[model samples]
Target: MERISTCLKFYLLEAGNDGSIEHVDKALIANLMTLFFAGRDTSGALLTWFFWLISKNPVVENKIIDEIRQNLAENASPKHIFSNVQELGKLVYLHSALSEALRLFPTGPFLLRVPNQKDVLPSGHKVDQKTKIMLCSYAMGRNAEIWGEDCLEFKPERWLSDKGGIKHVASNNFLAFSSGPWTCPGKELAFIRMKAVAATMIHNFHVCILDGQNIVPSISAILTMEHGLKATISSRWV
Candidate 1:
């Protein structure tokens, strides 16, 4: 109850005078609860795919480790926790890597929404109030026309600009977080959390994916490893 109230206060600001009571409609509460539950599998799915990509591309993993060392404080221990997200924010390569992974493997296979009014999508298709709009994010992520010929390749540098910063890809192009007025408000927080966890694990351990595991994405309702990740973990110092 306390945690839910805190979240309501932070995000919705609808926690009432005592800051502990939800003053929103029941629909809003249901949606908030859905977000909370959905977010967990989404996080786990992204991390699983990100690490799998890292394993397949040792060069990319090495670059991420190098970036971690560079951005980390000099005297910080291997187990250092990122108290300030600004520190993790400096890891451009790592961020790009995760973005690339998501580009290839969006956890949410598709997005479903009902149009509030009749409208035309950019694709020239007409949608009516009765239309149920479905956007297949997985297909969008792999579109060579949109992402270029090398779209199938796992290249983090593609997300970088000529100035060595994260390039601006339109939200519509990057549908991992959706687009327009209904875009996710928690996008920034999600990235920060992902960076912190990935950085910490990369800094402290030697993670190796063991053999004999079929690591394909499951056809389940929520995207996840079909057979689960068969991996071995050991301390870096070992």
Candidate 2:
């Protein structure tokens, strides 16, 4: 095995060129530490699962690449990809693919909550005040009753409308970001960041998972790859 790096380095990936925030050593370390838990980084885990899924589904990847090309400006070449988050929103297929990945492998696989007052759930279940309610986002996402027979399958079209637009799905049905008033406030920004990175990477490089690798998920506060992901990257332009 080859070592990409023998020492750790902070790669601060900024979304926009607006400006950079100045952070002291303590603040920077604290922020980075927040992203790690149980000795694993949540982002790394989610991305590992995403890339693993993408590798198994070549057809899906091809569609994502094709959609990126189609969304380019009329005068732009196929390789001329979106340079900002606003422009990246037009890549519908890529968005769907990402949603599909999260559906199957949510970063925060479980969400815990405590009821402020006694209430009955939609399912007619009664909850006591101050009682803990644990929602397994991972399980609900793959529920056949909610998503039908193809729930387990990686089909990005499930998120598309008849006319080829993004189909609106309730967070209840897709609890990747939770539901109702307490949903994730950074949902839109998260999507943009992911779309920006994924679009750029797929357009500029060909990512493939190495063969004979036993890829599996780990049990933790944030879902992570049991064994780290091993893959190869090569530039598409030659």
Measured by TM-score, the strongest candidate is 1
lDDT computed for candidate 2 = 0.75
Overall lDDT per candidate, in order of appearance: 0.82, 0.75
Instruction: List residue ranges in candidate 2 displaced over 4 A.
Output: 1-43, 74-82
| Prediction-by-prediction clash tally | 0, 0
- Please report the candidate that would top lDDT against the real structure: 1
> Per-residue CA lDDT of candidate 1, range 113-132, in tens?
99888999988999998899
Worst 10 residues of 1 by lDDT: 14-23
TM-score of each: 0.85, 0.78
lDDT of 2 at 10: 29
Candidate 1, number of clashes:
0
RMSD of 1: 4.4
For candidate 2, lDDT tens digit of each residue in 83-155?
A: 6765797899888888888888988898998898899999898998767999998998899998898999988
